[model samples]
Target: MPLWLMILLGTIFGGLIFFAIFMFVRSRKKSKEALGASAGETSKYAGQAPPEPEVLAGQVAAIREHDAAFDEGRFLKWAEETFFKVQESWTERQASGARALMTDACFADHERRIGELLAKNEKNELDALAVSGTAIMGIESDKQTDTITVRFNAQCADYTVNAETGEVVRGNKAVGAWVEDWVFMRARPDYLAGGGEMPAGGLETNWRLARIDEVMG
Candidate 1:
């Protein structure tokens, strides 16, 4: 999912939510780049150190201060759903469907790739997809924003085809798997917990997909 995961990591959005444009483009050689995308574009945070478990615990605790309702289980579900929808959009080379879930920068990245596919009348096809597991790697925040990184592990048959004749163009239709680190960001809410009542906001909104980094094996 090079241009994305369009999957763009929107391949999933730039990298399945990246069946990622990079996956196929990251294709590394698989179909449409598949979820098993290539390592084409590297995320800026790829090589940085991850927060230790203890630190991450503190980070989650801090997030709870901002969002008392933050739940890892529910967050992962959102991540999973985002992955599926972005992948679906990637297949169609349409990035808008996932616009609501991504930051403008992230959305732009996926959009650029989808546009390329449309210009060429090509489509990335990802199928037989299954997520084995998803987990958080890190969580942090600036004075005005919150950020979190999550890892997605999944498999699928990936390939690209000529939109008109359905001819195999660049990738193979073989099934394969991939791992990606998706970063999400959002503006800080107007209020923070002062040990008082928390906002009613759920884990949705207030956060948007920021970036996706392919985990190089």
Candidate 2:
């Protein structure tokens, strides 16, 4: 071959080899970066430990120790009954019956709502109130108080009526199911007590409704 032709061939071959080497090095670097990212993600998740089951058990035991009458079944029963009574109080456009069953703040909220209804001459009526199921969602006790949150699924015939003429206004008479969470609170006792009887005459009770919130699915 002539000298110029040989020089051109050599240059082209060298260029091809260099390009190949560059591509191989770039690919290896990308692979290493991807693997490093994956490992970092794995370690991040693995560093978090799940809560121990015994921790929750210990919390419940502590709460039970504070109130000897702290039976889950009994508390749930009371919650169901109180739910109905609260609905009844709303229907009657009064809060007297539920006053003893609620905390001061909760009672104040109820009275405020009732006052608003009374000002508008309106009342809510709930008939055939039936609780389908109830579940204890959580229980906790602090230095001075114990709180239990319960979830209730119930059906009731709801309607808004005019207080003066007793006429249906807003809601229909059909029964509808609703989900609600009710929080109950009581003073944390230093010693265990035997009876679960609710205290009378005082605005505060051993178990009183703290708040109620609707749960949306």
Q: Which candidate wins on TM-score?
A: 1
Candidate 2 per-residue C-alpha lDDT over 136-206 given as tens digits, one digit per residue, 9 for 90 to 100: 76777755567787777777666667888988766656666655667778765552243344433232337
Which candidate number maximizes lDDT? 1
Error of 1 at 157 (Å): 1.6
- Model 1 score (lDDT): 0.68
Candidate 1 per-residue lDDT over residues 1-217, each given as its tens digit: 3553232232333323345555555554444233321223554546655557788778789999867888877887988888888777778776778788777666776788788788989887776878888878888876566778888778877677899999978766667776678887766664343232332322233677776777742
Off by over 4 Å in 2: 1-59, 191-205
Measured with C-alpha atoms, the lDDT of residue 29 in candidate 2 is: 34
Error of 2 at 53 (Å): 11
lDDT of each: 0.68, 0.63
TM-score of 2: 0.65
- Backbone clashes for every candidate come to 63, 0
